[model samples]
Target: MAKRSFVWGLGRYLILATAGLLAFVAVVLVALRFVNPPTSAFMVAHQLSADDARVRQNWVALEDISRWMPRAVVASEDQRFLAHWGVDVNAIQAALDEYRSGGGLRGASTITQQTAKNLFLWDGRSLFRKSLEALLAVAIDASWSKQRIMEVYLNIAEFGRGIYGVEAASQAFFGISASQLSPQQAARLAAVLPSPKKMSAADPTPYLWQRVRWIQQQMAPLDGF
Candidate 1:
């Protein structure tokens, strides 16, 4: 009887703990709608790591950043940024089909999803992290505008080892401010995003240059942001 009672008690405590955690997460998500986050999980981890020196990041408002930046990122990362709520269904479907066909895995994460993961979650490909990212993406999409989403993503995205945000990346790679970035420079920065630590925005390889040109080509069609 005592063992059964203890089991029931443990279950009840777990339930309550889960509920409280959910409530706390919900509150934080809602609050982030109005507040700019100071730092992210990735940032904290990078700072704490012994091998990596603390990098630079300066948050510039969307209005302060170059207009080319958002367009460049949209072209390079998520083309349907303005259309999708949070998740891109077509991209997800394409990725699944590719995986089923035994093709190499492709990332289907949208900008909002990336923002959710970068801001609130740890770096990983685990199911639990993905689930939390999806939930947070939905909350962010519902609470924030597309412009705000783009702004936050630009500010928080990791560009290179210890380098974050367009402002920091611009200065680090080109010795310019985010507002002064040219179209080509912006495209190069966007191209390096997939593997910033390995790729160089300052000195692009042939493949990176190819991606930069492609991103630049995509910018015109995606103009008017």
Candidate 2:
């Protein structure tokens, strides 16, 4: 009888703990909808790491950034950014189909999902982390606007080793503000996003240039969002 009672009590405690955690997360998400985050989980990780170089990031409003910049990233990273809630089911299905057809595995993470990962999670492919990321993405999408998601993503995304955000990246690579970025320059920045550590936006490789051209071509339809 004592064991049964203890089990019941433990179950109730667990349920209450889960509910409290969820409520806390919801409140934070809602608060961040209006308040610009000073730093992100990834940025904090970089600051805490033993790396000698300092992390660079400068927050800019969506309007402060060049229109071409957002369109370039939308074209390169998530073409369906305006449509999806958080997850892109069609992209995931296409990726899975390609995998089934003996193609290399590809990621179909949406902009919101990437933002969620950068804001609250670490680098990993564990199932638990991915699941949590999806939930966070949904919460963020529900709480924030499309423009807000883009603003946070552009600000927090790593553009190079120890360099973050379009503002810092523009200064580091092109000696200009993000607002002054030309279409070609914005495309170059978007090109390095896939492997920021390995790829240099300051010194574009042949493959990087190829990607830049592709992104530029894709940017046409987005019409400088």
Candidate 3:
């Protein structure tokens, strides 16, 4: 009887602890909807690893950014951004199918998922990390507006080794502010997003230019944004 009682008590404790943690996460997500985060998990990680290099990031309102920038990213990263609810099931299935057919495994993370990972999680390909990222993405999607998610993503996304956000990236690459970025400049910046550390928006290789052109072509359809 004592052994059974101990097991039941431990189960109850685990359940209560899980509930408390979930409640805390809910409260934080709700608060972040209104407040601009001072720094994200990615930024902190970058700073810690940089040894002394500065991480540059400038927060700007959605209105302060060129309309082209958002359209370009939406085109390049997640075309179904406005339609999907946090996760893109079709994209995930497609990626899995490709992997099964002897193709390399690729990511199908949505903008919301990327935002959640950048803001709160570490960089990794582990299943546990992916699951946590997905849960956070759903929570973030439920709490924030579509515009807010884009705004936060644009600000927190890594553009170069130390550069983050449209504002900093634009200045570094084009000698212009994010608001002054032309369509070509925005497309170039968006093109480097897939591998920001390796790809250079300032000096595009032939391959990077191809991505830039593709992103530019895609931007036309999403221009209404």
For each candidate in turn, the TM-score is: 0.93, 0.97, 0.96
2 versus 3: better TM-score goes to: 2
The Cα RMSD of model 3 versus the native structure comes to: 1.2
Q: Give the 10-residue window scoring lowest on summed lDDT in candidate 1.
A: 46-55
Q: Over the stretch 15-113, how does candidate 1's per-residue lDDT look in tens digits?
A: 999999988988987787688899988798888883866868998999999999999999999999999889899999999999999998888889999
Winner on TM-score between 1 and 2 is 2
Instruction: Give the better candidate number (2 or 3) by lDDT.
Output: 3
Runs of candidate 3 with Cα error greater than 4 angstroms are none
lDDT of 2 by residue, 8-67 (tens): 999999999999999999999888888988888888888888365598888999899999
Candidate 2 at residue 2, lDDT?
100
> Which numbered prediction scores highest in lDDT against the true structure?
3
Segments of candidate 2 deviating more than 4 angstroms: none
Clashing pairs in 3: none
| Clash number for candidate 3 | 0
CA lDDT of each candidate?
0.91, 0.91, 0.93
The candidate that wins on TM-score is 2
